[model samples]
Target: MSRLPTRTDTPPAKPDPADKRAAWADAAKGVCIILVVLWHVVVKDYLQIDWHIGVPVPGLWGALGEQFLPLRMPLFFTISGVFAANAVLRPWRVVARSRVAGFLYLYALWLLIHTAILALAPDLPTDRATSLLGLLEQLTITPSNLWYLYALALYFTIAKTVRRVPRALVLVPAAALSAVAAAGLLDTPGNRAGLYQNLVFFLAGLHLRPQIERWAATANRRRLVLTAGAYVLALAAMAVAGAQRWFGVWPLVSVVAVAFGVTAAARLGRWPALGDRLATLGRITLPIYVIHMPVLALLHRLLHAPVSGLDGVGQGLIVLGYPILLTGLVIGVSLALHRGLLAVHARWLFALPTSRRPAPRHVAAAR
Candidate 1:
């Protein structure tokens, strides 16, 4: 004991607020991506079939997806805004090349990929550009289900352009646009409705970055529970009053849901294992989001016979388990495809090719 040198253990370092905020955003993104894939699985795969089961699979799952309408895309756009908060401040050309160009390149590339794959699975029940004009329409005037890419390209441009404008001037009109779109006063065909309704959220995330970061940094179990309760009560009130579609109602509901989402995600980040998994998914959401629909479409066609044969067997379990299993499968297959593509040096499918070869994971994943 006397001969042995005394040693002292160092105390563990406290988690940094910045790291916490990043993890919180990643976890929130993870939740959003899963919901996106699940929505597609339900609508495009589950509801597309004639299960012929006694259970009201379509109605029940449809209603569930509808309830999540306020949360999914709004939180997604908001988180995107938060990530691009600094990018907008960079030189215009840089933002153009990195954000605008990157998004548009992916949009055009995937538009073709989706069109080609979806053409073969025409009976799988998804919207796609059928002709050259339809492709042009999707490219210019209207966007397809892959509109998120188009929206991001446009949003980044708008955000960077208006970064010098008064926040109220920019946000008020964006909010009005959302209200009108939500109220069905605007004609937002295809996924244009999402493109229109979510700009306010993205702008809010960009404009209110400090507040959002502060909220995430200070989020706790108590605050999360309280915020979630308020969100539920608000939803209940809206439902009771039949104002879910009122001009301002949807945006308000979406805001509350975003609050709850952020708080819940922040709290989730405090946990080590699960948070890490979610954060990892969050970082790679672009591949899952872009590729899931096509994967699901293909799977639906390939598995049609098998899935249909299960119609009468364990109807109850199939009702709930089918969508969940399909969602997991779509996500898994898409991720595997992404890795496989990278393994073959086909990274350009996900990112813009540069003169100097880009990194294997060069895709802009902020969205």
Candidate 2:
């Protein structure tokens, strides 16, 4: 079995200073985070509730979001891997204190928080543990919407353990595991499948850091266009052939989508206003990721009845606007709530309470 790095090993290198030009990574994260929020908005809120509006438009929105399934979380994990490459190289004591402990702490803290809040709105359409045993399951074997945190902590440990191994040794198995999970051969409960399927992308982000950085830095419109075209064509072909879940199809699709996502991020980040704003959102994605679900649950409870009772014009408006509008509202509320918690010195809600200064924004937001 592999062991953690000993203290006598070289210390972790300090991260690069935040470069305005590298806003592409954050932009990529912004695109991914928005899609994630949109997915939850469509699935958990729009699709779940009995809409006075017809299902056709809502269903269309859901399908469109589904088309990006290969992109969102995979891209997020890839960028996270890129950001975490440095941190995972540190001695066990440092990696444990900064990365592992912080993630598990937030996972445990927010697991309770999610449980308590969701308990109040049990009718809202979302997963929640109804019993102590179920809650224990979530803390251990199962994964909730908060699975990203759980996976991050685990991935860091796995990457560090295999750091001394050959690259193929780590990546090949991770890719095969992803292919297996994406094929649904594995019975992953709740969001546990994501924990299995996305390991390869994260590892790629770590192992292929130099190439990825170069790709981002040198990305141009032609490459973006080519990648986007290739991804869309591949995705469409798979969907048309209905082979999306065939043993290895989904992983290939995701790799193409990730390339497209990175290229698009690089292109988009060239625009000053958009790039800066996305970079800003990327910096705070952690808060949005953890807080959005509960906020959406509450919002669903509050708005479902009112929205369901809307008349024809209101219903029509909802069909056209519900997913995007609801996603934006949820993200806004989540960010505000995070700011409020910080103001109250409830910093532990987001991170482990330690005397060490918080990790730099890029390093910390990888989760």
- Which lDDT tens digits does candidate 1 get at residues 122-160? 887677998899999999879988888899889999999
Q: What's the distance in Å from true for residue 203, model 2?
A: 0.6
Q: TM-scores across all candidates?
A: 0.90, 0.90
What is the RMSD, in Å, between candidate 2 and the native fold over all Cα? 7.3
TM-score of 2: 0.90
Tens-digit lDDT track for model 2 on 1-367?
0011111122223223356334888778888889999998888878776665544787788889989999999999999888888888889998887777777877888989999998977877677999999999999889888898888888988988899999999999999999999888999889888999999999999999888988888888899889999998998899899997798899999999999999889888878678767866776678888889899889988988788787867788667787888899999999788778777867667767767687899998997
| Model 2 misplaced stretches (Cα beyond 4 Å) | 1-21, 52-55, 355-367
Instruction: List per-prediction Cα lDDT, in the order shown.
Output: 0.83, 0.82
Question: What are the clashing pairs of model 2?
Answer: none
- Give the number of the best model, judged by lDDT: 1
In TM-score terms, candidate 1 sits at 0.90
As a whole number from 0 to 100, the lDDT of residue 39 in candidate 1 is 92
Give every collision pair in model 1. Answer: none
